[model samples]
Target chain A: MDAIVVSRLTKHYGAALAVSDISFSVPAGSTLGLLGGNGAGKTTTIAMLLGLLLPTSGSIRILGHDMARDRFAALARMNFSSPYVALPHRLSVTENLRVYAHLYDVPNTERRIRELADELDLHELLDRPAGELSAGQKTRVALAKSLINRPDVLLLDEPTASLDPDTGDMVRGWLERYRAATGCTFLLASHNMAEVERLCSDVLMLKRGAIVDRGTPGELLDRYQRDGLEEVFLDIARDRRPEMVP
Target chain B: MRPALRRVWGMVYRHLALYRRSWPRLLELAYWPTFQMLIWGFTASFFAQRLGNGGAAGVGVAAMGMLLSGVLLWEVALRTQMGLAVGFLEEIWSRNLGHVFVSPLRPWELVAALIVMSVLRMLGGVLPAVLLAWALYAFDLFAPGPVVVLFIANLMVMGWSVSLGVVSLILRHGAGAEALAWTVLFGLTPFSAVFYPVAVLPAYLRPVAWALPSSHVFEGMRAVIGPDAIGPDAIGPGAILWHELAWATGLNLAWLAAACLLFAGQFKAARTRGALLSIGE
Candidate 1:
């Protein structure tokens, strides 16, 4: 079954269409990369899927539960992450994770916490408050938080936007392994073409609230006759739509 | 229900840790309220003692009545204001509101965490303010009796009432609502019957005062400590305490329910139309 089914989702902010009618689905255990520049309605789409933003029209079925009416069912099995938001700065990394651990009612809390800490290299920072951590450390903590519950549906926004290359590569590697082990589904929104190319099995390029193009990384590269995903993104951002080739 | 409350407790723990870590800034935040209470309490108590009836401790219970209830009303206003300002707005400063909401935490859990933290602030500051008063005039800090319980309940409801109103305003606007919250409070203070008795209010404004839950707080507190005691009768052992207790309990419940409804509507508006997240995001 598809892990996420967004059917013609539209979000209107007064007269401005933040996310025009758009539709897509993510198969369980697969990854879909949502690539867009600023104001491309990327966050809006992610928010709607998370039930953080209500759609003006259409429906969202996440994990086979209707988001509009039965969001709790989906939310219970789902989680999201973004570096822009943070865990309480004053709480130690352990404290922050403990809160979420209790929140999800994760059984055998200590074990799960230890596992995530070891996996995320957070043991050294466990005693430090989350606010005191550097940007890279914060990203790791957030990643640990997102994985705390072993979520079935994981939606991430710019997961590695500001990370140093090494740290970013490590996080990407961990996500890949985590998904492989759990067969978890993922919807990643990022501007990092390499990350998208490395991780996403499919790509959806958005422009001004609409899906301007979509394909696998190689397919998109071939269709745009471009050397890399970066050139393809530039072509789309500069209003250079690729011609369809049958 | 237990799970939900546990979540709130977890949030409280985190909040306490944050406050401890940021003790410097937190102390600064407490500075204004601490000073406000002492200055206002001393000045009000002085006027009640001299220019009015009995000077300082010599004044009749009428003076005690005004001063006691004034302190209680300020407690309510300060909690409600800071819950919105200090507690909720802290999320904005830390840029953690989005993370909080996206977690397993619900809206009520966050609200409870804010209110409880606000109450703890009272625990830290209220005694010191009362002690300062006790030092000057030698009034017992604990002399307020069961009325003190009523005062705390009153403050909780008032916090809920004002926080809901302010949260609603935040949903429609953004940080602009901060100035508006204080502005609304300043506009409503005189109308709140916080200083003088509600009887002194103008005929038309009487309805306005009656509408505000804080007015009832002052009335209820004064009923216990005033010259007439429980009623037109005398102090009569614990009779005054019982009467004040009944009114505070009943009115606190009403204010709580109303506050819940107000926040419910605000949450609904927030869910749709991009209200929960700040505007222009």
Candidate 2:
């Protein structure tokens, strides 16, 4: 079964439709890129998938568990990362990690936390308050928090944002290795086309709360005659031919 | 044996971390309570003088109660609302509201943490207020021992019951509703009989005060401390014990059960409305 199965999932804020009749699925152990404009509803769809927002209509089955009615059962095996949601600012990195560790009920939490700190180059940051960290460091900490439970399904929103190029590449490399090792599914919402090209197996391009096109990175490039994912992103944003909603 | 302590330890560590960042903000939370107490201490002591309850003895009693119960109940009330207000506000400001709630931690666990921290804060706040009431106003500070301890327990129960509704209102209507909490809370005070005997309340208002947990708190506290401060003349021992204990025991049990239900319902409602994460990072 797919790791995340969404169908006719719609969300409305008053008369405005944030995500309207959207549908997609990520096969277990695969990565899917969610692309959209400033208000194309990528975040809303993600919120629904995470059970943060109840859908105005339709259904979502994530990791074989119903998100609407049985979110906790599925949430046990899932985790998410985003810079926007920060850990307590005054909390040190280790303390922040401990909160999630307890919440996730991770076995050998101290050991797991140590492993993440070493893997993410966060050893020196363990004692620093979370708000004291630089933006890039915060990104890595957020990633560590997401992985604290060693989830089977990882939902990341701009997981590598604001990192040095070297660090960003290292993060991507680590994510790839982790996915390879655990076969965990990743649903990443990102603006980094190069990162998208590097990590995502398939792309689902969204426009105004609906999918305009979806295919493998290579397929989209070949079909649009674009040199890279960035070109394809631009074309979609411009509503150009090859990715035109029609 | 070890595990429960470990869980409690973990909960303490987490709040300690949060306090590290929020210490400055918390100073802001304290400002209002301090000001509120100063006004009560200064103004109510004025009234304490005119009532013949105004002798140096009366001034001392009034000042002591203002310092003691004022700081005590106010601290309890402040801490509970702070937990709800700041906790919910923390979720909203962090933009991680979705991430935190989506994890295995239920909302009650979150609320419980806030209450636990609030309790600690209440204890911390009381120490200084008591000393100041003595140094500044020559108030008789009777040592409470176990009686004061029971009063602390009642303070938490009553404080949180009211705060749950306050927090729930904030979650549902957004922080704009926060202004209403104080106005509502203040209006409750006169009816609560926090300053005087509930019997003194008008015939109609007497029942209102009877229904309040604070009425019990003031009554209970008076029983314990009044004897030391006023000797046998202040109020009957049996009547004081019955009234105070009745409010503490009877009201706490009823309010606790009702508060738990309301808290759970608020949790479910906040989740459905996407307000849980709205309170988190």
Top of the candidates by DockQ:
1
Q: DockQ values for all predictions?
A: 0.57, 0.44
Query: What CAPRI class is candidate 2?
Result: acceptable
- Considering summed lDDT, which 10 consecutive residues are worst modelled in model 1 chain A? A237-246
lDDT per residue (tens digit) for residues B189-269 in model 2: 777656566767889888878777777777766665553445335654323475576667688788778877876776666
Per-model TM-score versus the true fold: 0.88, 0.84
Give lDDT tens digits, candidate 1, residues B1-281.
Answer: 37687778767776777777777756755565557666666776666657455333424445654665476457556645565446776676566666666666778878888778777765565556656656765655346575666566666667666666776677667656766555665677786666767778889888887766677766655655544432344443323545444655576677668767877787777778655555324
How many clashes in each candidate? Answer: 2, 12
Winning model by TM-score: 1
Q: TM-score for the second chain in candidate 1?
A: 0.80
